[model samples]
Target chain A: MSNNISLWLRYKAKLVVTNVSWGLLTFSSRYRAGMLLLFLGLTLALFQSGNPRFLSYRMVSTILAQCAEVGLMSLGMSIAWMLNGIDLSVNDLANLSALIVAMFLRSIFRPTNETVLLICSLAIALTIGLAGGALNGLLIGYLNIPPILTTLGTMSLFRGISMGLTEGKTISRLPSALAVFGRTTVLAIPTPFVILLLSCLFMYYLFSFTTYGFKTKMTGLNPKAAFFAGVHTKRAVFTGYIFSGLLASLAGIIIIGRTLSVAYEYGTQTYIIFALLVLNLAGIKPGSYDVLALLVAVVLLQTLATGFYSKFLTLQGGPFFNLFLWGLVLVVVLALSRAMERWVSTRS
Target chain B: MKLTRLLRHEVVLCLFCVFVVLSIGSINPAFFSLATIFEVIRGAIPYMLMGLGVMPVMLTGEIDISFVAIAASASLATHNVLIRHLRYQGGLAGYLLIGLPMGAFLGAIVGAVSVFSGLPLFPVSLGFWLMLYGFNLFFISPEMRFDLPPGLTGFYRRFLVTVKDPVVGETGLHLAIVYVLVVGALLAIILRYSTFGRGLYISGGNKDVAIRSGYKLGKLLIVAMTLNGGLAAFAGILQCAFKRFFDPILFRGAELFVIAACVVGGVAIGGGRGSVPGVLAGVFFVQLITRGLVYLGIKPVWHQFVLGSILLGFIVFITTRQKLWVIFGRRKR
Candidate 1:
C-alpha cells in the first residue's frame, strides 16, 4: 500500500507547474489588469463578429450608460463585501431613493428653477439612501444581526415604502433639470460614466489611503479580533454600510436622470445578481478588490446584455439565451480562477 | 425540561403564529374559518416542501441557493421532455419518475462540483443558481409553458380532502400537501434516527470532531447538497404541476426568501440545529402573513412593508432576548 501510494504521488499527482504563463496571467496586478482588458476586448470582438452594428460608436455609448448603472451597483456591493457582509438591498434602496426624489419633485409640480429642483432632488435621494444605510448598519452592527438577514428584510422594506408612497404607480415626465445626470456629457463622456469614474476613484482612495478603511477591513476579516484590538468594529461596520447605501443611492439618481422616471419595480432583482456577478468576475475578496477590474467586468456584462437584447445569437434562442451564457460565464470564470490559484500553489 | 424546551425558537414561532392569526382574524372575522386554514395549507405546499428540502443542507452548515435553480431546470426539463417532446399521456407518476432522478442528477452535479472544487458553499451554489436558471432559459423554452399534457390537466384541481365552506361553497385541501407530510415525516425521521443525519449536524457544528467520528466528511457534504438539490427540484415540479404552468423565471428572487423562512424556523444559520416542526411552523407563519394580507383590505403596497417589519422585529427579538433578560431579569452572568 505504501509503495502504491508513493507511485501514485510520483506520477498520477504530478502537476505541470510553470511560472511563465502564470506571470503574464496573474503574477501581478498590472498583468492581471492587462489580461482582463484583453479578455474584454476579445468579448467585444466576438460579439461584433456576430453583428457589425454591435461594434459601433453608438453601441459603445449605450454600453457605457448600462455599465454605469451596473458599475455603481457592483461598487456598492463591493463595500458590503469588504466588511464581510452583503448588501442585497442596494438595488432596492436605489429605487427607493429615486422614488423619494421623484415624489418630491412631482409634489412641487414644478418645471421652474431647474438648478434648485435638481439640487433638492439630489439632496433627498442622498439623504434617504444614507438613512436607509444607517438602518442597515444599526441592525447589523449595533444590534448584532447578521448582515444577510438584515439586508434581506431591508430589501423588501425599502421597496415596500416606495410602493406604498407611489401606490404602485410610475412617476414619469419629471422636470428636465432632474435628468441632468443622464442628459449632460462632459467632453464627450456621458455624465453617468463620469459619475461612475469619480465614485470608483473616491472609493479606491478610501480603501487604500484611510485608517477607517483599514479598520473596516480588519473588522470584516475578524470582528472579534478587530474588536479586541480596539478597532471600534461597530463604527467601522456602521460606516461601511452607510457608504454602500450612498453608492446605491447614487446609482438610483443616475437611473432617474437617464430614464427620467422612478418606480418601486425599477432596477429589479436581476441588477443585484448582475452586480454580484461583477464582483465575482473582478475576483474580489474581503478587504481586497480591483476597482478597474470591476469597471471592466461591468462593461463586459453590459456588452453581453446589449448583444443579447440585439439578438446576437438569433439562431439559438436569441435574447433568452443570454441568461444561460451569463450562468456559463460565471461557472467558467470560477473554474479558471481556481485553476490559476491551483497552478500558483503547485509552484512550490 | 419539556417546558424549558418549549421556550425555544419553534415555540416562539408558534406563539407568533397565534398572534398573527388573532390580529388578522380581528381585521377579517371571516378568516377564522377552517376553509381558510385549508386554503393556506394548499398555498404553502410548495413552500413547505422547499423548506423541508433545504433543511438538510442548512443543517450541514452550508447554504445552497442553487436548489431553486435545481428546481427550475429540473422541472422545466421534465416538462419539455415528457410533455412537449414525448407527448406522454400518463399521470403524475411519469412526471415524478423523470423529474426526481433528473433533479437528483442535477443535485449530484452540484455535489460533485462543490466536493471537487472545495470552494465556499455559498459562492459555488450562487454560481450554479445563475448557471442553471440561465441554462433553463437558454436551452429550455424561455417562455412560460402552459400546455400541460393530458395527464396533468386534472392535476391542478385534484385534492385530497374536500370541505364545505359557508360562503365559498366548496374548498378542498390540495393533494400536493401530501408531499409535504411525507417529506416532513421522512425528513424528521431521518434527521433523528439516522447516522447520516447525525453526521451532517456533527460536521456542520464541528468539522474536526466529525472527521474523528468516522464520518466521511466530503461524501457526507456532497450527499446533503444532493438531497437539497433533489428536494428543491421536487418542490418546483410540484408547484409547477399545481400552478398548471411552468415559467423560466419561477422563484427568481426567492433564494433569500426561502432561506429567510428556513432560518426563521429555528434552524441555526451556522448549522447543527433544526427541526421538521420548526420548519413547518416557520413556513406557516410567513405564508399566513402573505395570504392573509389580501383579505385585510390594507392594499397590496403595505403588505410587503408589514411583512418586512414583522420579520425584522422577530429577528430582533430573537437576537436580543438574552440581552433583554439581562436588562430586565436578575442581571448576572
Candidate 2:
C-alpha cells in the first residue's frame, strides 16, 4: 500500500512538473478569456466615465433583457459548432417558430385560459423547433450534406415558409399574457434573464453529466474514432441539431415575448454574425465549452450595445460602429489567442 | 457512354428551362415570348458575376463570404471617389477600370489575413465580412446616393434588342449580356485550359494530393481570392449601373442566396469540380424558379420557400444517390 501510494504521488508529481508546469499560460484559451474579461471591465469603466448612467441598475436590467435572444441563439450555435458544423438556419428557424406560435395564439380571441394557451403555444414551438432541427440533422447526418450548406438551404427555406404564410405581414400584438416572459421580473431580474439562466444551467448539466453530452463531444472531436469506439455518431449529430433547434425555437418565443410581434425577417443577416462573434470570443469548443465565459461574453456584448446606443448615438455613424468594432475584435481576438498559444508553447 | 456523359446536369438544366418556359407559356401565352427568356438571362448577370467571382475560391476548396464585403467596399469606395471627390463619371469604362483593381486588392487582403492569422479561411472570411461592411458603412458612407454621373445616366435603357409589346410597352435584351458571355468564356478558359487554373482543380479535389504533388496552396489561395474580389467588384459596379443608383446597402443580403444558386447550378459544395457555364446555368436556374413564379400566379413571397425547398431537395438528391445505392446493394448482398 505504501509503494502504491508513492507511485501515485510520483506520477502526479511528474504530471505537475514535466507535463502541466502549473502556469497560467498553459491553457491559453482560458488566458485569452481572462484577458477578454479584463477588457470588458475596462470598457465598462471607460463607458461609465464617459457617461455616469452607463452603470445603473436599470441599464443592467435592460442589458439582461436584450441579451436573452442572442444568448440563446449563441447557445444553439455552440452546439452546432461542436460538431465542426454550423446552423445558419437558427435565426430564421427561431423566427418561423415564433411566428407559428403567434399565429396559434392569435386565433384565440378570448384569453380566459391564458396559461393553457401559453403551454399549448410552447408545445407547438417545441414541435416546430424539433422538426426543423431534425430536418437539418437528417440532411447533415444521413444525407451527408455539408453543415453550412445544409443550414444555408434550411435558412432560406424557413424564411420562405414564414413569408408564404404571412405574405410579409408582421403579426402584431400577440396575446398579452404570452409576452409575460418579456414583462415579469423575479427579484428585479427579468423573466427573459431567468430563462437564459435556466438554459445555461440546463446546457451545463446536459454537457457535463449526460451520456448525450459525452456522445456529442466525442463525435465532435472525431466521428470516425467515436464510431470505432462504439459511439452512434450519426444519432449524436441528429440529437445535437435537435437540441440546437430547440434552443433557437425557445429564442424565437422570447423574441415574441419582447416585441409581441413576429416578422419573417426578425434577426436578419447580422443576427448570425453576432452569435458567431460571441462563440468565437468565448473560445467555445466541443468538449470544453465554458458556460460562464459564454454568459460573460453575452453580457459584455449587451453592455457595449447599450453603451453605444445611449452614449454615442450621434457620433461615428451610430450602430455601424459597433459592427465595425465587433469585426475588428473578432480578427484581433482570434489572432491574439493563436499567437498567445504559440508563444506559450514555445516558451517552456 | 461518351454521348450520355455529355447529357449531364447542364443538359438537364436546358431541358428544365424548356419545360418551365413551355409550361408557363401554355398557362399564359403572353409569357411564352422569347423576350421574357432574354429578360431572365439579363437579370441573371449580376448573380452570374457574383457566382463567377466565388467559383475560383470555391475551387480552392475554401468557402468565401468576404467577397460580398469586398464588392460593397470596392464599389462604394469607387463611387465615393467618382461621385464625391472626382465628380468625373465620363463613361462605364472608368467605373470598371477603377473598381476591378480595388476589388482585387481587397480580396488579396482577405487572403493575407487568412494566411497570417493561421485560421481556417471560413472564419477569417467571416471576420472580414463583418469588419469590411461595417467599416465601409461607418467610415465611408452610410446614406445611399441615387444621383448618377452624367455618363451612366440613361444607361439602364441601353438594350441590345427591343420588342414592342402591346401590353408591356417594350422589353428587350440588355446590352449587359455581352459582359456575362465574355466573362464566362474567360473564366472557362482559365479554369479548364490554363495550367494555373488546373491547380485549383487538384487542390480543391484533395489537399493532401495537391501538396504531395507540390502545389503552393498559399499562393493559390491568394490568387483565387484576388480573382474573386475582382469579379465581385465588377458585378457590384454592373449592378449599380443597371439599377441606376449607388447604394451603401447594395447586395446587403445576397451572399447566401448567390451561394445557394451557384450550388444548384451544379457547383459542388466542397469544390474542385464545376465549370463556368455550369455556374451560369445555376444562376439561370435560380432566376427562373424565383421570377417565373410571378408568371405562374404564385405570390412573390413564396419564392423564398421554393428556392429553399429546391436547394435542400436538390442537394440531398445530388449527394445521396450513391450512398443509397451502396446501402441497397449491401442489403441485396
Candidate 3:
C-alpha cells in the first residue's frame, strides 16, 4: 500500500510540473503585453478611485459582461488578422444578422414554441453570417480586390441593407428563449461570458490543432511560399473570411440576447475599435495564449470605461472622453509593442 | 494624332461624365437648368478638393483617411473663433486666416507621424481619424448648430453671376465655382509640369529606384501628406461656408467618397498612375450620380448602396478590362 501511495504521489508531481512549465512557456511568449496589461488592470483596480470599487465582484462581473460580444468579435478578427487580412464589416455583419433574427422573431412567430423558434432564429442568423463571409471571401480571394476596400464596400452595403430593412428602427420584445443565451447566468457566471469561454476554446483548437490553421498561418507568412508548398492560398484566404463571418454572427446572437433587442446600428460605436485594439495589442502570432490575451485586453478596456463613468458621472461629454481615452490607449499600446519588439530584437 | 494623344484616361472620364449629365437631363428636363448644374458644381467642390489632396498621397503610394477628421477639427476651431469675434467686426478673412493655416499644420502633423513611425499609413491614419474625431466631439457639441457671422453670410449668399429666371427663380453662381477652377488648374499644372510631381511619380513607381536617384522620399511623403491635410481642411471650410451652418458631423464619411472618386477616375490605389484631370473627372462623376439619384426620387438610404456598387463595379472593370484586351489581342495575333 505504501509503494502504491509513493507511485501515485510521483505521478501527481510529474503532472503538476508539466502543467506549470507549459503555462510558463505560453506566458513568456506573450509576457511583455500580458504583463503590462495585468499591471495596469491591477493598478487601476487597487488605486484608480482609492475606493477599490474596481476590485469588487460586481465590477468584475460587469466588465466580463460588457466584454462578451466584443471579445467574440475580436476572436474572429484575430483569425483574419493572423492571415494579414482585416474585416471592417464584422460589426455590420453582426448587426445585420441580429436584425434578421429579431425581425423574424417579432413578425413571423408567436412565443408558443420557444425551442423551435430559437433553433430557427439561430439558423437564420448563422446563414446570413456564412453568406456575408462567403461574399467577402470570393471578392477578396477570387476577385482580388484589396481586403480593405472590399470590406469597406461591404460595410456600407450591409449597413445600408439593415437600414432599409428596419427603416432605422429598433426591433425589441424578442422571445425569452433567445435571451437565455445572452442574459441568463449559469452557476453565477453570465451566459454570454460562458459562451465566450466556450467559443474561445473552440477557436483555440481551430487555430492550433487544425490543418486549416496551419495553411492560414503559412499563407499569411508568405503567400508565394505557401502556394509553392502546395497550399491553396486563395482557399485559405476564403476560409479565413468565412471563419470571421461565422464568429461575427455568433457575436450577433449574443448581442441580441444580451440587449434583448436588435438595432441597425448595434455594435457600431465600439466593436471595430475593440477588435482592432485587441488584434494589435495581442500582436498577431496566434497561439493558445491569444485567447487569454484578448480577454485581458477586453477587460482592461471595459475597466477603464467603467472607471471613468463612475468617477465622472456628472461630466459633460463623458462618452466622448471615453472614446478619446480608447484612441489614446490604442496609440500608446501600438507604440509600446513596437518599441518592445525593437528592443528584444536588438538584445537578441 | 495630336487630338488622340490628348484623349487619355481623363478624356474617357470626361466623356462618361457628359454622358451621365445628358442622360439625367433627358430623363428630367429640370436637371438641365443652370441652377441644377451650379448646384452640382457646388456640391462637387468638397469632393474635388479632397480628391486633389488624396491624389498626391496616392502618388507616394500612401493613403491618409484622417483628412476628413482634420477638416472637421479645423472647421470646428474656425467656427469657435469666428463666433468669439462676432462681437468684433470681422469678415470671412478672420476665419480663413485661422482655418487655412490650422488645417495645413494638422496635415503636416499627420505627414510627420507617418514618416516617423514607419508604420503603414492606413492604420496610423485610422488612429488619427478616431482621435481627431473624438477631440472634435469633446470640444464642440455635435448637435449644436452655429450660424456664420452676418457679414460673411451675406457676402457668401451673393452670386458672382446671376441670371433672373421667371419660372425657376433667380439662379446665382457662387464664388466656389471660381475657387474650384483656380485650385483645379493650379493642381493640374503642379502635377503635370512640376519637379515635385515627377518625384512623386518616381517614388511611387519604384521606391528603391527613387532612393537610388537621390530623392528625399521621407520629405516628399511629408509634403504630400501635409498638402492632403491642407486641402481637406479647405474643403471643410468650403462645406461650412456653403451650408452657412456648422455641425460636427458635416463631413462624416466624405473621406470614403473622395477616395472612391479618385479610384473611379483611374487613380491606382498603388500610386504612380493618376492625373489631376482624372481625379477631377472622378469628382464630377460621383457628384453627378449623387445628384441624379435625388432627381430620380430614390430613397436616400439607397444612395450609399448604389455608390458602393458603382465603386466596386468600376474597380472590377478597370482591373479586368486590361487583361481582357490583352487576351483578345493575343488571339488576333
Candidate 4:
C-alpha cells in the first residue's frame, strides 16, 4: 500500500509540476499583480507575530468546527458548479433537512438511548436530505430551467418549509450520541474532519474511477458534444444537482447533530461562502480528488483564520477579516487559472 | 396568442394579485379600503425602490448582492448626517438631497472592488457585506438605535399618495414611489435606446469578444458597479424615509430576495439578456407570492418552502437546455 501510495504521489506531483512549469514558460508575458498580492498576504500572516507558531492545530480545529457546515456544503456546491451550474438553494435545503430531522425526532421519539437513537436519527436525516436533493435534480434535469434562477427560487422556498416545520422555534432535544458524533474527538481529531475525509474519498472514487464521473465532466466541458456522443447530458446535470442537494442535507445533519439543536438562522448566511470557496479553490472539475482538494483548501483557510486570531490581533469579528481574505484569495485563484488555461492552449 | 405568450410570465403575477384582492375582499371587506390598500402599496415602496435600482445590473446579467449591505451602510451614514450633523441647519431638503448621493458614492467604492477583483460575484460582494455590517456597528453604537426625524416622516406621510378605493380603485403612490417608477422607466429607456446600455449587453453576452472588439471590459464593469452602487445608496435612504428608522437588520438577507426577483424575471446568470419590464414583473411576482400565501391563511413557513422549491424548479428550467426528445414529445417513438 505504501509503495502504491508513493508511486501515485510521485506521478501526480510530476504531472502538476510539468503543467505549472509549462504554464509559467508560456503565459510568462502577462503581469501577475494578483498573485503578488496573495504572496504578500501569506508572508504577512506567516511573520507578523512575536511567534506565529501559536497559530497551531488546536486553533484551526476549532475554527473548522465553527465553519464546517458551509465547508461541507461547498463539497456539493463544487460538483454543481463543475457542470457549469450552481444550486443557490443549498443553504435553505440544508436548513430544511435539519428542521425536518429536529421536528421528527422530537415529535416521535422520547429522549432516551444515546447510541441507538443517534444512529436512527442519522438514518432519518440522510433519507430526508436525499429526498430534498432528488427533488431539485428532478426539477432541473427534466424541466430545462436555469440552475441559478431555479436554485434562487428554491432557496427561498426551502427555507420557508424549514421555517414552517419548526414554527419559528429552536429545537434542541437531540440525543447525546448525536452530540458526541458532532463534538467528540477520536484520536485527537474532530469527527467532522473525519467525515469530511471520508466524503472526499467517496467523491474521489465517484469522479475519478467511474464511467459516470467521466460523463459528468464531458457534459460540463461541452454539452453539445457530450449529447452527440450519446451521453444523457440532462441526466448528468440532474444527478449533479441531486448529489449537491444530498450533500447539503448531510451537512445540515452534521451541523444540527453537532449542536444538538437546530436554529432557523443557522444555514441562511453561509450559502454564498460555500459557493465562492468551492468555485475559487476547486476549479471546475467534478472528481473525488478535486473535492478532497477543496476540503484541504477549507482547512488551509481555517488555519489562516487561526493565525489571525492567535497573533493577538483584534479577533473581535474575526469572521469579517477572514471573509476579506477569502475574497482576495478567490480573485487570485481565478486569475491564475485563467492565465494557466491560456498558457496551456497556446502551447498545445 | 402572441401577445399572451409575450405576457405568459406576467400571468402568474396577475393571478397572485387577483387572489390577494379577492381574499381580502372576502375577509375584511374593508381590507381593500383605499386607506388599507394605500398602506400595502406604501409598504411595497422600499422593495420596489431596490428592485428598480438593481434591475439594470440584472438586465446586463450581472448582480450586486452587496447592494443591500451598501444600502444599509449608506443609510447608517445618512442617519449620522441627519441626526448628528443636520441638527444645526433645520433645513430638511439639503439633508435629504446630500444624503442620497453620499450613500451612493460609498456603494460605488464596493462596485469598484468587484470589477477590479476579477473573482466570482459572491466573495467580493460578501467581503463588502461584512465590512458594511461592521462599519455600521462600529460607526454607530452597536447598542445604540435611533429614529428618523418626525419632520421627514411627516413629509412622506403627507405627500405620498395612498390607494384610492379598496376594491376597485388605484393603489397608493408616494414621492418615493414616483422616484422608483422614474428610475425603472429611465432604465427601460436607457437599456432600449442608449449606446452605453447596448455596450453593457454586449459585454455581458460575450466578454472575450467584447474585449477583442476593443471594448474596455474593466471600465464597463466599473460602470455597471457604479450604477448598482448609486442605486443601492438611493434605495437605502428611501428605506430610511419609508421605515422611519435605520434598523440595522431592516434588510437582512435581502440580497437573495433581490437576486431571486431578477432571476425570476429571466435574467441570465453569466451576464446579459434580461429586460427592465421583466425585472419589475419579477419583483411584483415575488412580493405577490409572499403576500398571497399569508392572505390564504397558510403558515408563513410554507411560503418559504414553496419559494425555495419554485426557485429550484425555475433555476433548473432556465439553466439546462431541454432535450430534443422532451421538446418533440418523445421524438415520434
Q: Compare the candidates by TM-score and give the number of the best one.
A: 2
- How much is the TM-score of the A chain of model 2? 0.88
Tens digit of lDDT per residue, candidate 3, span B1-333? Answer: 354357567787888888988988888777777777767777788888888888998888877788998888888888886686555346666777788788889888878776775666776677778778888788676565556676667655567877665445776787776777788888888877888888899888999988898899989988888788778878888888777777676687777788889988988867788988788889989998999998878888778778878887787777776677678667776
- CA lDDT of each candidate? 0.81, 0.84, 0.79, 0.66
Error of 2 at B193 (Å): 2.8
What interface Cα RMSD is found for model 2?
Answer: 1.7
**What TM-scores result for chain A when each predicted structure is judged separately against the true chain A?**
0.88, 0.88, 0.86, 0.78
Off by over 4 Å in 4: A1-70, A110-116, A282-292, A307-348, B1-12, B81-92, B99-114, B120-123, B139-151, B160-172, B200-221, B263-278, B292-303, B306-333
Write the number of the candidate with greater TM-score, choosing between 1 and 2. Answer: 2
lDDT accuracy of residue A157 in candidate 2: 94
lDDT of 4 by residue, B63-133 (tens): 56777877777667767766786663343465457656765676566656656545545556665676566
The segments of candidate 1 whose C-alpha lies over 4 angstroms from its true place after superposition are A1-17, A28-30, A44-56, A108-111, A307-317, A346-348, B1-3, B157-160, B214-217, B325-333
Docking verdict class for candidate 2: medium
Q: Each model's DockQ? A: 0.49, 0.62, 0.40, 0.38
Model 4 / residue B29 / CA error / Å: 2.6
In candidate 2, how many Å is residue B200 off?
1.1
What lDDT tens digits, residue by residue, belong to model 2 across residues A1-348? 999999999999998885564365665455646756876899899998998887898878888998999999999999999988998899999999998888877775434698887788788888999999999999888777889888989998999999999999999977788878787788889999899999999999999888889889999999999999999999999999999999999999899889989999996767787788788778786666778788888888878777867766778686888778777877776776666666666775
Using DockQ as the measure, the top candidate is: 2
lDDT for position B5 in model 4: 56
Task: Write candidate 1's Cα lDDT for A1-348 as tens digits.
Answer: 999999877775453343355565555434455666887889888887877778776678877977898898889889889888889899999999998888777785554777777787888889998999999999999998877778888997887788888998988998777667986778877889999999999988888898987888888888899999999998998988999999999999999999998888986756877887788777777767688888887887787777767765546675455656666666666666766666667753
Off by over 4 Å in 2: A1-24, A31-36, A108-111, A342-348, B1-4, B324-333
